[model samples]
Target chain A: MRTASPAPSRWALRVVGLGYLTLLLLAPLVAIFYKTFEHGLAPPIEAITSTNGLHALKLSLLMVVIAVPLNTIFGIGCALLLVRHKWKGNALIDSVINLPFAMSPVVIGLALFLLYGAKGWLGPDLAEAGVEILFSVPGMVLASIFVSIPFVVRETVPVLQEIGTEQEQAASTLGANAWQTFWRVTLPSIRWGVAYGVVLTTARVLGEFGAVSIVSGSRSGETETLPLYVKKAFDNFEFPAAYGASVLLALLALTTLLAMNVLKRKEDA
Target chain B: MGISVEGAVKSFGDFQALDDVSVEVPDGSLTALLGPSGSGKSTLLRAIAGLETLDAGRVTIDGEDVSTKPTQKREVGFVFQHYAAFKHMTVFENVGFGLKIRKWDKAKIADRVHELLNLVQLPGLADRYPSQLSGGQRQRMALARALAVQPQVLLLDEPFGALDARVRKDLRAWLRNLHEEMNVTTIFVTHDQEEAMDVAGQLVVMNQGRVEQSGSAEDLYEHPANEFVMSFVGEVNRLGEDFVRPHDIEVVLEADDRTEEGVVKRIVALGFEIRVEFVLGDGTDVWVQLTRNELQRLELREGQIAFLRPVQAKSFNGSTPSDPPGASTPQGSDDGGDAEVSAAV
Candidate 1:
C-alpha cells in the first residue's frame, strides 16, 4: 500500500510557520526593495552615487576588509586552543571567547570608548603619538572586531571536536610533522567550518551599528559607514538614500546566507 | 633491526595503562598484541609507535632510542581502527602523503603509490575518495597509505576491528600474505584471540597493564605460562589447580577407579565435533570435546553419568581449589598436573 499523507495537524503547523515567516520576514524584505525603486530607480541611483553615499560605502568595505580577516584568524586560533588542548583556565578562556555574544554591542562600544577616549586610560598616550583611536576608523574597526569575535570560533569548535585528533595522529605516524599534519590533515577538514564562520563574521561586521555609532562619531563623509549613513540619511529626510543603502546591506546579508547554505550542502554531500 | 620496549610504564592519573611492560619484537616478524578491551595492548602499541609517551622507561627501534623522539622521526607506520584515511583526499593522494612529506620526487611518489595500491590489492582505484570505498577497500587503502613510506615497523591498532566478520576474515588472510612479502617488523593489537592466533608469528598476551605471556601461538596454546595465559589464550576448563582444554579431556561411558566420574549436563553438536558439558563430583564444570563418530557411538545424552580423564593438563600456581570459574588466576605458575589415566599418552 502507498504511504499515507501527512496528518492534518502537520499541514496546519506548516501553514502557520509559512504564514508567520511571510508576515514577519519576507514581507518586510519585499517592501524595502519596493520602496527603494518606488520612483522608477532614478532617485535611488542618484542618492547612492552622492559623495556621502560613496564615502560611507568605501568606509564600510574597508572596515569589513580589516575586521573580518582579523576576527577570522583570531577565531580559528581561539577555536583550536579551546578544542585541541586541555589545561588550566580552559573553561575560562572558552567563556571569554563567547562573551562577545552575551554582552550588548552598545556596552562593548562604550567599553572601547572608555579605554581609548582622549581623557581615558591609554587614550592620552595614544593621542601623544598622534594616534587618534577614539572616534576614528581604528575605533570603528575595533568595535566591529569585538562584536563579531565569536562567530568563527563558535562555528569551528564543534567541527574540530567532531573530527577529533585521529587523522592528525595518523598523519604524524606517516612521518608528517606537527605543521604538516595541521596543514595537510587538520586544516582541510576544518576549512568549511572556518569559511562558514567567516561568512557570519562578515555579515555581522557589515550590519554592526550600535557599537560602531558610538566609536565612529558618525561624521559625514568621514567615519560614516553604510549603516550609520543609512541612519544619517533617514534623519536628514533622504528616504531614497536610506532605503537604497538598506537594500545593499540586505543583499550582502542575503548573499552571505546563500553562501552559508551552499557550503553546508557541500559539507553534507 | 627489530623493536624493543624496555620497562615502559604509562599512567593516566592513577589508572595505569601499562606497568613495567617490556616486549622484544624481532625484525620481519608479525606479532599480535592480544588482550581484552582496556588490557593495555593498544596502549603498548601506541607507546612503541611513539604516539603515547611513557611515564618511565624507553623504546628503541633498530637498536636506536626512539622514546624521546617524535612519532614522525621514528619511522613507524600506524593504522587506526576506524581507518583514518584523509576523507577529502583521493586514494592516490592519501597513499602518497607520507612520501610527499619526505620530499620524494613526484615521479617516485607516483611509482611508489602505484606499487602500494597493487600490493594492497586495490590497484586502479586511485581516484576514489575514502567515503566512496567500501569498508574493506578503505581498510586496504589505510594499509597502503601506511606502507607508502616503507616504514621500518608497521603498527596497527585493531586494524580490522570495524569491518564485518567476513571482511575481517578475508583481510586477515590477505594481511598474512602481505606480511610474508613485505617482511616489515609488524605489530597489531586485537582483542580477538582467534585473529591473533591465526595471523601472529608471535603472540603477546596482556592483562591489567602487565604482559601475561609472550610466545608462539602453539606454545601459548599447548603450554600457557600461568592460569591467566592458559585461560586467555584459549577456552579451558579449570579443575582444582589444573587447566585443561576441552579437546584434552577424554569422555568414557564406563567409570573406572582412576577416572573422575561426572554427569553430562549438556551436549552441543558442532558439525565436526560434539561439546559435552560435564559437572564433576566436586561441582566443577568441564567441557569434553568428542568426535562426531565417537559421540554417535556412545549415544551420550544429558543427565547420563560419564567418566572423564585428563589426557593432558597443566597445574598452575596461585590457582586455589576453591577459586571460582572466572577468577583472574595469578601469574608465574608451575606447569604440572595429575593425569589419572596415562594410557592415551
Candidate 2:
C-alpha cells in the first residue's frame, strides 16, 4: 500500500475512498447517534430501561449466552472432522455446513417452525410431552444457534489445515498423548482463528432478526428480543425506544468489529 | 539400544512407499537412510518411529518389538524436516514438553531443558519463542527438544534439508559431534550422498521402496550391490552399457589393444579433479576423471583422439535402471575384471 506514486493522485484516491465510505457508512451511523440523542438522552434512557426494553435486552443476551458456547464446541469439532479426518461423505458435509450462510434467515426460521411446530414432524409427540420448542425460549435459542454455527467452523478449518499435523506428529513422538497434543499444540496454534469466529458468532447472535422473529412468536415481555422490540417500537411510533435499541445494537456490532480486527492482526502476525 | 525393521511393507494407493524392507543398525551407531526423492527413506524412518504404520512388519528398539505400540509409547524422538518447533511455546517450554507430559518436577525440568539447550549450543535463548529464532536456531532447538527425552532411538527425516548449504554442512558436523558425545542410536534420512558419507557410520541406500544396499560408506562406494547403488552413491558415466565411475577410467596417448579410442569432447578443471568428457567411437559420451598431475602427464586436448583404459572400474553385467532385485549379476569387487568395452555399439 506504500506505493511510490505521485502525491496528488494518491491524495485524490484516499479522499475519494474516504468520501465514499463516509457517505455510505459513517453518515448513517452519525444520523443514528444524532437522532438517538436528539431531545437530550433522558427520553431514550427511560425508553430503554422500561420493562419491555429490559426484558428484550435480557432475552437477546440469554440467547447469545446459550448459543455461542454450544456453537463454539460444535464448530471446533466440525472443523477438525472436516480437515483432519477422512470419511465417505466429507465433501457433502462440508457443503452442508454452509447452508446457513446461503439461505435467508427467514427461510431457516420457517424450516424450524415446520419441523417443530404442532402439525409438523416430531411436533405431536413434543406436544404430548409438553416439550415446547416452537414459541418458546428454546425455539429462539435454536434459531440463533443455527444461524451462527458456520462462523467458527469456517474460520477454523483453513487455519487447522495450514498448520498441518507435523507438530502433532512431533508431539506424539515426544511422548505426548492425543489429548495433550491437542490441548497444548493444536489448540494454542488455532486460538486466534477460533477467536475471530467467536466474534462473528457473537455478532450474529446479537443482531439476528428474521429467524428468531418467526419462532419467538413476538411475545411482549417473554420471547421478544432486541431487534424485535426495535421494530415493534418503530411500528408503534415510539421513536425514542426504537432509536435507543438500534443504537445499542450498533454499539454491540462495533465492539465485535473491533474484536475481529484485533484477532485478524494476531492471526496474520 | 539400536533399532531394526523386519519385513516392513507399506503402500499409499498402489505406490509402494516401503516394500518389505528390513534394516539393522548396530547399537549406539549413527546410520543414514539415504536415497533420491520418493525413494522411501523418510517413510521407513517414520515407520521406525511409529509415526507411520507398516502393513506387514515390526519395529524393534532395544530388542523389544514396538510396531503395534503408539508413537508415544515407542519412546523414539523424531525431528522433522521443517523443524516443527512449537511456535506457541518458548524454547525452554518446547524442550521441556516431554518432561512435562511425564509430570516432571518444575526445577528438574528446568535443569534438563537447560542442559539440552547447552548441548545444542542454543544457550541463553530459552525465553524466546520459535518465531524469534533463525532457521538454524530453530532446527537446533528441535534437536535439543528431541534429544531431551533421551529415548532409546532417534529418527530424523532430512533434518538439514531445509537449510542452505553452509548451514547444512555446519549442522551435519555439529550433529555428528553431538552423536559421538551422546552415543545415542540415531537414524537420519537424507538424499545427499555426501552428507551421508560425512557423518553416518553406516549408509543404507534405498530406491523405489526397497533398500538397495546397506553398509559402511566406504563399503558402499567401493562395493556397490547393483547399478543403482554404483550410480547413485557417486557420479558415474555410462561407458557403453555398463556404469563407470569417472575416476576409474584412465586417459592414455598410445593406441593399445587395452585402450578404446575416443575424441576428447570437453575438459573441465573441477576444483579438486579434472573432468574430461570423451565422445567414444560409438558416439556415446563418457567422462574420465584425472588429477592435474595426471592431465599434465597425458597432455590431452579437446577434439583430439585419446585412447582410454579402464582401471579398477567397478562394472555391472546389466546396468539397466529399474531392474528388479536379483535380476542383475554383480560384477563389481569380484574377479577384478577390467572395464574394457571394445566399442561394442
Candidate 3:
C-alpha cells in the first residue's frame, strides 16, 4: 500500500529547485543581456561591429571550423578502436584518452607549446620549412583540439560498446562485406552518439579559453578570439565592449545547450 | 547441397570449443546439434557457417570447400539466439539488406521482401521497426532477413532459445513446415532434447566438444552408442552396467531369477500414465511407467514389495554412469556404486 506524497512538501521541493536554478543560471543570463544594452542597443551593436570585435568573432568561428571536424573524425576513429578491438595495453590506452578531461587546459597548452613552439621539438625543421605554429592560428587550433579530444570519444565509446557486434555479424552472414556492414549496420547504430559528440565538440571548441589564450598570443585583430577580446576590452577599461562580447558568448553557449537538449530528446524518442 | 564438416577443430585460448568434430548434413534435410551448455554445439554451428575460423580441417557446402572463404562469401544464412535484427531498420529494410548489398534492382528487392514477410507470416508489419516488434515477431523478421539472400545453407544458433516455452513450441512447428517447403539444408543448435527430437530429421548428439552420436532420433533413442548418449537422449534406468528405460521395465508379483524384488516408494499420476518408483534388493532404485488401468489391475500400493523385470536393456562396458541431481537415491546404501533411474518422460 502506497500513499501519495503531501502536496505542500512537493511544492516546497519544487520551489527550492526552481529557486536554485533561477539564482545561479537565469539571473546571470538575464543580467548579462540587460547590462549589455543598459545604455542602449547602439553602443553594444557598434562595439560588436568594430574591426577588432568583428575580427575576434571571425577568428573564434575559424578556430571552431578548424578544430571541431578534425577532433570529430579522430574521436570517432579512436572510439571505434577502443571499443571494437581487444589488444594488449588497452586499459592503458583507454585511460590516456581520458587524460585531457582530468588535466587543466593550460597544461595542455604548455605541452603543445613545448612540442611545436620555436626552439621546441621539431621546431627547427618546421622553421626551416617556413611553417609557423606557435602564436598562430594553427597553434590555437591545436590547443583547442587537445582540450576537446575526450568529449567525442567519451560519448561515442559507450554507445558503440552497448550496441555490440551482433548486428555486424548478422550483416556479414547476410553477404555484407566489411565496408557494407560498417556503413549499413554499425554506422546507423552509432549515428546519434556521433552527432551528440559533434555538438559537444562544437560547444567546447567555441568557448575554449585557457589553452587558446596561451597559444594565440592575443594579438589584436589577427589571432585574438572573442574570449580574448573580452579580456582585452576589460583590461583597457572598455566596459561596454567587454559586456557586449560577453553577451554574445553567453548567447552561443545558450544555443549549444538548447541544441543538446533537443538532440537528447530526439535520441530518447 | 549438403554440408560436410571434416575434422573441424576450434579453440579459444586453452578451452577447446570444437575438437576434431565432423558430420554430414544431408542436402535438403533438417538437422540438429544437441548438447548441454558448453558442449560446443553452437561453436560447431558457427564454424560451419564460417563465423568462426577453424584451426584445422575443412567445411564443404554443396561439395565445394568453404574453409578458406570469409563469412560474407560463404553465402550462409545464420540466425542468432537473440535475433539480432537491426533496431534502426524496419522489417522490410532488414529483410532487404542482403539483397540491397547484392545489388538487386529496386522492384525485385521489394517483391522479394514482400514475399519473405508474407512467408514469415508478418506481411503487414514490414513498416514497423524491430524495437516496435514482439520477441517472436523479431525472430521471425530475423529469419526472413536470413532467408532473403537465398543462402545455400541455413544455420540457426538456438533460434528459439530466447523465447517462452509456448512460443518456442509454436515456432518449432512453423520452422519445420518452412523447412519442408523451402527444401534447404538446415542445421540448428539446441540444448532441449525434445526440440531436437521433434524438429530434426537427423540428430547429432555432442558432449565435451565431441560428437557422441549422429543418426535419426528414433535410432539414437533406441540404440545409443555410449553412456553419454544413453543418458542424454532419453530417460534411462541404470542397474549395474545395464541402461533401461522406464517403459521397458515390467513389474510382477512373483520374483524369478531374472526379476529383482523391489518396494514401491512413490507413485506419480501424470494424466495418462502412472510412474512407480521402486527400490531393488541391492538398493538400486528404478522407475516403471504403467497405464492407469494397469495400475488398477495390479492393485499396487506404496511400500508394497514387487518384482521387477527388464523387458529389454542395453549393457555397456564403459566407465560408471552419473545422474542429474535430485534423482531419487538408494535408501540405506553403503556401496559406492550408485545407479539412477531418470523420469524425464
Top TM-score: which candidate number? 1
Ranking by TM-score: 1, 2, 3
lDDT of 2 by residue, B1-345 (tens): 978889999999879999889999999999999999999999999998888889999888889998899999988889999999999999999999999998999999999999999999999999999999989999999999998888888888999999999999999999999899989999999999999999999999999999999999998887787778988999887754466678767687987656788999999998868999999888988888899999888888999998877654444664333211112332323433323222211
DockQ of each: 0.88, 0.88, 0.89
Off by over 4 Å in 1: A1-6, B258-266, B279-284, B302-305, B318-345
Kindly report which residue stretches of model 3 are placed more than 4 angstroms away from their true locations once superposed.
Answer: A1-23, B251-270, B273-308, B318-345
Q: lDDT (0-100) at residue A117 of candidate 1?
A: 92
- Pairs that collide, model 2: none
lDDT of 1 by residue, B231-309 (tens): 8888988887667788877777886654788999999988998899989988988898889998988888899998887
User: What is the alpha-carbon lDDT of model 1 when measured against the actual structure?
Assistant: 0.89
Per DockQ, the best of the predicted structures is 3
In CAPRI terms, model 1 is classed as high
**Best to worst by lDDT, what's the order?**
2, 1, 3
lDDT of 3 by residue, B1-345 (tens): 899999989899999988999999999999999999989999999988888899998999999999999999999999999999999998999999999999999999999999999999998998999989989999999999999999999999999999999999999999999999999999999999999999999999999999988999998887677778888998889887677889888888987666778999999999889999998888888999999998998999999999887766654563344422222332231123433334231
Per-residue alpha-carbon lDDT of candidate 3 for residues A1-269, written as tens digits (9 for 90 to 100): 64867899889989999999999989988988898999999888899899999999999889888888898889888888888888877789889988888989888888887888787897778988998888999899888888888888988998999998899999999998988998899889988888888888888888888888888899999999999999999999998899999998888878888888888887888
Q: What is the lDDT of residue B290 in candidate 2?
A: 94
The window of 10 residues in a row where model 3 chain A has the poorest summed lDDT is A1-10
Of models 2 and 3, which has the larger DockQ? 3
Candidate 2 lDDT by residue in tens digits, A1-269: 86587999989999999999999999999999999999998988998899999999999999889999999999999999998998978899899999999999999999999999999998889989989999999999999999999999999999999999999999999999999999999999999999999999999999999999999999979999999999999999999999999999899899899989988998888
